[model samples]
Target: MKAKKSLVALAVLGTLSGASYAQSSVTLYGIVDAGLLYTSNVKTAEGGKALLQLASGNLNGSRWGLLGSEDLGGGLKAIFRLENGFNVNNGTLGQGNRLFGRQAYVGLASNTYGTFTMGRQYNALQDYVATLQLVSALTQFSTHPYDNDDLNNTYRTDNTVKYATPKLAGFQAEALYGFSNSTNFANNRAYSLGANYSNGSFNLGAGYARSQSPGAIGGAIVGNPSSATPSNPLLDAARVDQWGVAGTYVLGSLTLGLLYSGSLYTNSTFTLAAPRGTIHFQNYEGSVRYQVSPTLMLVLGETYTTVHQSGESGHYLQTSAGADYYLSKRTDLYLNAFYQKASSNLQANIDGAGGAASGSSQAVVVAGIRHKF
Candidate 1:
């Protein structure tokens, strides 16, 4: 009788363990991308020079992440994700050498309600409008001049709380707030809102974001590095505002896309030698994608950007093209090229190519492979 009782207890424990395991799950995923890049013009102290080098994260940033979910019953679940970005070329961490720089968030999700998460995460423009822009989806070098609108996701917000609404009638919305986490509550704070509507083959999205005293604190929406001078041009701004709208439509084997975005910075200093003033940028983009076959796709995009600062204005015109071929569901090869021209004493600087051009025009080409697991 004693033996039988022990066996029954062990069976009960096993049953409980199995049930618990069924209610929780964790997944590991990653992407690795590398490329051979060539630039027609890169500025030097003396003159422009052509460059050829190996680069990483051409189509997508190389990253790995862990995602977990626990079913808590009553149509609610606990979810968490930790994502890290790295440079495959030199095996160094990206995003200022911080671990899990891409995203680190945990919160509750409900089927009827929505999701609430807290941690380092992207803002509204990256979540909504960026998805609708073909350039953002295709390659990093295609972003609007210096990624002024954050559509290319140049930065993520830290100490952030985000809420996303459940899809209702083909519409979804989200909002986020990033606290400064300092004695001064308003310093380095940020907020954003985004919404999207998807109906059949057509989609539209809009988003807005703002930050106060960006780069004021290490844990703020835009963190400051240990170095005395910041690397990014917009880091030392007193205030930053960004807004955008985008739309996409699928017609047979072709898809059409359009995007418009604006960024404004107040009391910002670009460099140690530069003066503090207000700077504004406006971007307009259009793109088209054609599916040649089940595994081959072609894309073309163009952008016009205007900048105004200190009673002077400049403009940039950029054109980009790409072809992608899928070797398998998890692997692909791509060739992309870009050309940019600047006016009014502005220097052409294609995103992710390297430095600014010595002249008013620059061009770049990249061939790459991407794999996902």
Candidate 2:
């Protein structure tokens, strides 16, 4: 009888262990995007020349990632993610070639409480306000001047801790802090806060972020200066502040979006002329998306950006249009076009294009296919 009881107890324990293992799961996901690109002009020492080439990540960046979750009982869970960015055309790693440059984080989550995560992660601007751009068909191609406000997720914060509140009454909030890990304490540190609200057909978001002595510490807010290719040229700044507000409304199959963002780089070392003070950028954008049919969608957008320096200023007016045809639930074909005009003798440089134009105007057209799995 004693031996039989021990055997039953061991069987029960084994069954419980198997049940726990069943509660854990891991998923692999990725996106591949490639396209043919045509640029009206590419700046060169000889002036400007039209160019055609194969481009990667026109609508979305090519990337792959693993997401995992383990249930901890009572509405709690342990979660983690590792994401990598790459160039599909050259088969090269993106984001300075880090193994998991896009995102890598682990956290605990509770259905009743909020979530707390730590690792290399996106700032509040990228979490909240940047999502508003998804309603636009041109998504990544319509970034605000050099993505200075980080609306395009140009970079991620390192050694960071973040917390997000559970949605209540259509409102949610989040905050983050990134440590410099230097003896100086404050050098290259970063912080951000953001909030979102949604009601019926309307959604709104606002965010603010600041970094001190960005790029001064390795793997900090902007990553290492030597390895990271920051979208904004003025990364060597004493301080960087970014803030933005965006809103979107869905009316049946049509959506409208509007956004405003600002980036301020103070005491920057990179400058066109002497006596560098501050470089400030303000961006305003409006976009509309229409679903023409079950499988076709179209978008139109315009952006006006202004830049100011110690004693001079410049302006940019950009227009964008695109169409997407869904080949299936996980694949699509897209066509996008962009034109930009600049003032104050500044050259027009469309994002993702090879180079800037020698004149004040530039245009680009791209046809691509995207697959998600």
Candidate 3:
């Protein structure tokens, strides 16, 4: 079967090539999703960016890009994709000025078995972490404020080789391994494996991930000669750990989902000159959603987080409710609002430590639209 397909592909490419007209195809595809936004307490009490301002991603980020796959030969194929993310209002590049920041990966696919690829890849947590957020396409209202730990970025490993299993009987699994890009102990890296099962109106999935850091990023300003600005070290052995599970089931016009996540910081210490011994930090969460109609639906979500400080203990409850409406296949509009409250060792916040944080409680509300193509 593979040999026959290869010959057919070569024959088609040969007939289309060496022709008079431009035979190569470079098509463009992307999303330009943006809308009105209203945010409260955007900054600190020190007169930071706190106030209602127009924002992007009330639904999605504004972006555009290209994708194409060429017939190289045999059963093998040559494929490349470039996607860029940007702010629509002022036209600024998103994801830190990366041309293909949204996604930049190239590799081959097989008709049978599976496909292998490499690049900066989204992690398993993204697919299984917090429910309310991932379900909303990683909504801003639900992703942060609860855990700035960024189980989001930095967590997304770089230089990764990923394998996606063929979808069979509504079942699929993904495996990924990332390189630390270091000279020694390449094994000192990160990786994850996750699988999803979906059939009819029911769906479920679970995942696991592990990553490490050489050390914390404290600098001269904190009082260290090694840092250009003088730095601090909470713990020379500080490392970041994260893992989570998510599941969702749909019936008729309604769908329900749940998620949980946690992190561990070993040898978590103070950013001060006098460091303490092995301290620790962790987090937990849960959420759910329901659909009212195809164009309009209701969302009720909540997350609970607990932190065990080296010397203090704290926790917070975040509850939210909102509505989502699909304007079209490429466009979606939503309004989300959430409230947060903290307790137990409430105000004694951690200093400039590289461990889990227990910041002050705040509320967030936003209404926006997203479009994809």
Instruction: Rank candidates, lDDT, best first.
Output: 1, 2, 3
| Pairs in steric clash, model 2 | none
TM-score of each: 0.93, 0.92, 0.74
| Model 3 residue 274 CA deviation in Å | 14
List candidate 1 stretches off by more than 4 Å: 1-16, 223-231, 271-276
Task: Give the clash total for candidate 3.
Answer: 10
- Candidate 3: tens digits of C-alpha lDDT, residues 153-234: 4224557788877679988778887776665433336677777777886666666665554242221011122443222232
List RMSD in Å for every model shown. Answer: 4.6, 5.4, 8.2
> Scored by CA lDDT, what does every candidate get?
0.88, 0.86, 0.56
Candidate 3 regions exceeding 4 Å error are: 1-27, 41-50, 71-77, 128-138, 144-155, 186-188, 214-237, 268-286, 344-359
Clash count per candidate: 0, 0, 10
* Residue pair clashes in candidate 1: none
| Tens digits of lDDT, candidate 2, 54-87 | 9998888899999999888898999999999999
Name the candidate that leads on TM-score: 1
For TM-score, candidate 1 versus 2, the one ahead is 1
